[model samples]
Target: MTKDEFLQFLRDPDVCKEIFEIVKKGGKPAVVAPQVQPQQKFSSIADKLKTVYPNANAPQIQPQPAPQIQPTPQPAQPPKNNAPKGSGSLADKLKFLRGHLDKVREEEQIAAAKAQEKSPAEKYTVISNRRCPICEKDTRVVKTKSRINVEKRDLDYCIHYKDFDPYLYTVLTCEHCGFAAEEKKFSGAWPNKLKETLREFLKQNDMKFPFVEERNAEDALSLFELAILFSEMTDQSKGRQAILNLNAAWVCRCEGFADRERDFMEQAAVDFEVALENERWPINGISDDMATYLCAAIYFLINEYDKSTTWLGRIMNNANLRATAPKLFEQARDMWQDIKRANKA
Candidate 1:
C-alpha cells in the first residue's frame, strides 16, 4: 500500500478497534511471511533424484552457448566531397590578377551639399579589395557606405541616390577568372565538392569583363548573372540564390529595363516562395515577417491577389507582429489595403 493508503487504514475505526482488542487480550500481533512454491519441473526433478539415489542430489545440465550472428558486409562507400588541395592562397592569385588590370575607378563628380555645423555628413562610398570565395582572386568592389538621400518612397521602399547610383557597384568580378559574387559571398570557404567543381568550371570559361572599380547597371547585371551560375554549381541555399536574383532584378530596375526587371522579379518571387517553405529562418537578415512582406508585395506586383492576401492576412492577424516588427506590419497593412481598394475599383 502507498503511504497515504497505509495512513488511511490506520485511521479506520474497525482497524483501531481490532488493535485495541488485541492489546486488551495481551496478545501480540502475528507477522505472516508469504509462501513461495517451487516450479513443477523442479519438484519433479527432486522426486526423480530421491527415487534414483534415495537421498542424493539432482543432476546438473550444461548450458548451451547462444548462436552467433555474422553481420553482412556493407557495399563500398562513395568518395567524400571535400576541398581541393592547393599550393598558394586563392586571394594572392586574385591580388596578382588585379595588379595587371588598369586601375580605372569611377566616382560621381557631384559632391554632397554642405551640412550644417552641428550635422556631420558621412562618406557616400567606400572602395573595398575583396577576394572571391570561389576563385580566390581579389577584385575591387565599390560599396555604398551611406546614402545621400534625395527622396524616399513607401512603394518598393525606393531611395534615389543623388550623386551616385551605388547599387550598380555591389557585385565584385575577378578579371582573371570569370568568377563574380556579392561582397557577402567573398568571406566564407566553399564545400569541398563545390570548390573542386568550380575549379574545373573556371578552366573552360575565360574572364569576360575587365577589372574596373566602377560598374554600370549592365556590368552589375553581368556580374550578378555570373554569381547566379556559381550559386547553381554549389549547394547554395534557396534564400541566398533568391537574394542574388533579386539584386540582379534591382540592377535591371535601376537601368529602367522594365521587361527584364519584371522577369527577374517573377523568378525571385518564386525562389523566395520555395525558400519560405524549405529554407531556414532569418536568411540574409530576412526574418519570416520580412520574407512574408516581400512575398506579399511580389505577389501583388504579379497580380496574384489571392496569394498576396493569404500572406498579408498572416502578418495583419498575428497578435504580436505589430509590436515586434512595426515597420513590416505597417507595410503589410498598407499593401493589404491597396489590394482591397483595387478589387473594389
Candidate 2:
C-alpha cells in the first residue's frame, strides 16, 4: 500500500480497531480477504489522499526516462546524370571533328582567295622536267589550280615546268592518285622529292572535318556515305568521341542565354536530325545507343522538349533500340514527363 494510504489508515480509529481484532484472532477472518469491500474502499480513499497531499519530506518518486529514439536508415540513391546539357558523350568528338573540318575549310578559303588575286592572263613560268608516268615528258609545271577531289585538291599544286627547260627537269606524280605535277626550272628530281615530302606533310597535318561544313547541305545519301566512312575510321574511339562531343555541346548550352540556348538546342536537334536522315534507324551498337540516349537527355534538360521527345520516340519506336537500352529510354521518358508536368503546374 502507498505511504499516504497507510498513514490515512493509521489516522482512522475504526480501521486500526478492525486490524487489531484480526491480528488478535490469529490473522483469520470468517469471510475471505477477497470479499472484504470495506478495506478495498479504504485503500482507494488513501490513494486519493496521497495524490492531494504528496509528502515532499517523504521518499522522492523518480520518473522513468523517455525511450531512446533510433534513426531510420534511408536507401542509397543511384548516381545522377552528370553529362553535359545537350550532347552526349559523342558530342565532344563530333565537335572535335567539326574543328578539324573548320580548319580545312579555312585553309581552302585562304588558298582560293590567293588564287583569285592572280590575273588569269598573268604568265606563269614553266620549267622542264623528266618524264613521270603520270605527266609524261614535256609536262609544264604551273601554279596549282583548284580541282574537286576527296584528297587535297586546293592544296595540291600542278606541274607545268618541264616545257620551260630540258636540263632542269622537275615533274612529280601523286603516289596514291597518280595526279601529275611539274616544277619550275632549276629544279630536278628534287622537285619530285619535295612533292612527296609535301604530300606526307599534308597527310600528317590532316585536320578533322567540322560537322557543319562537312555535312551541311548534304542529302541523306551523302551523309550516310560519310557516316559509314566515319564509323570505319572511328572504330574503338567512337565512344570517346561521343563523350567529348557531349561535353562541348553541354558547356555551350549551359553558358548560353535564352537565344543562345535556343540556338544550341537547335544545333543539337540538327545533329540528331542529320543522324536520322542518314541512318533512318537507331544506332546498332550499345555504345552508340547509349550515346544517342545521352543526346536526348541533354535536349530534355535544356528544355528542348520537341527535339528531346523526337529522339526518345526514335528509341521507343525502334524495337531493337528500345530493347537494348530499355533503362535509358525509360529514364528519358520519365524526365520528359516530369518536365511537361512541371510546365503545366
- The local distance difference test score of each candidate is 0.68, 0.43
What are the models' TM-scores?
0.60, 0.27
Best by lDDT: 1
Per-residue accuracy of model 1 over 163-245 as CA lDDT, tens digit each: 55666766666666666666666566677788788878888877557866556778778787787778877866777777777
RMSD score of candidate 1 (Å): 31.8
Tell me model 2's lDDT, rounded to 2 decimals: 0.43
Per candidate, the number of residue pairs that clash is: 5, 33
Give per-residue CA lDDT, model 2, range 1-345, as digits (tens): 689867886777544554555565567532233333453443475454344334312332466899998989968978864434464446666776788789999999999999787442132223323343322334323332333232221100112232121111112232232332223211224345444644454366542222221111122123223322333342323332233233233333323334543554454445544554454333333244554665576567666667667776766676775576676666666766766786787
TM-score of 2: 0.27
Worst-scoring 10-residue span by lDDT in model 2? 151-160
